[model samples]
Target: MTVALMWEARAVAGKGEELLTWATHQPLDPPPLRRETFRAPEDRVLVITWWEGTYDTEGLPELPEPGEDLVRRAVHRWRFETVADGV
Candidate 1:
């Protein structure tokens, strides 16, 4: 099965660029099948990583949260499995 992990965060004030840089550099041991990063208005940063595994797979690699000073609130994360219809 294929799993996609989504991580999103909002940076503090004018630290959008810093947060972007930080998010892109996070390392996943053994790495994911695919990874992507994005930014939006309100200094929000989003990262999605795809891996080959089940949702309950143990020890799945995930990006850790950034330092408190860099973000205004806790990060958001979600996991999804590929749909049968491939949507």
Candidate 2:
């Protein structure tokens, strides 16, 4: 099964762009099958990475936290199993 890892953070005031840039540059140890990034309202940035394996069952790599100065609040993360794919 494919696992999807989601990482999200809210940037401080006008640091949205900076945070997004930082996220895009993050280096994955083993690397993911794919990665996508999105910018939401209220200075939020979301990053989702797709990998092959079950969550926790396999030794999947974890994303590192960004500098405290860039974010307004604590980072949020979630792991999910893929049920279906349309494309």
TM-score of each: 0.93, 0.90
Per-residue lDDT for 1-87 in model 2, tens only?
A: 899999999999999999999999988888999989999999899999999988775677767788999998889999999778887
Error of 2 at 17 (Å): 0.5
Q: Could you tell me the TM-score of candidate 1?
A: 0.93
What C-alpha lDDT values do all the predictions have? Answer: 0.93, 0.90
Index of the highest-lDDT prediction: 1
Predicted model with the maximum TM-score: 1
Write candidate 1's Cα lDDT for 1-87 as tens digits: 988999999999999999999999999998999999999999999999988987877788888989999999999999998878444
Count clashes in each candidate, considering only residues at least 3 apart in sequence or on different chains.
Answer: 0, 0
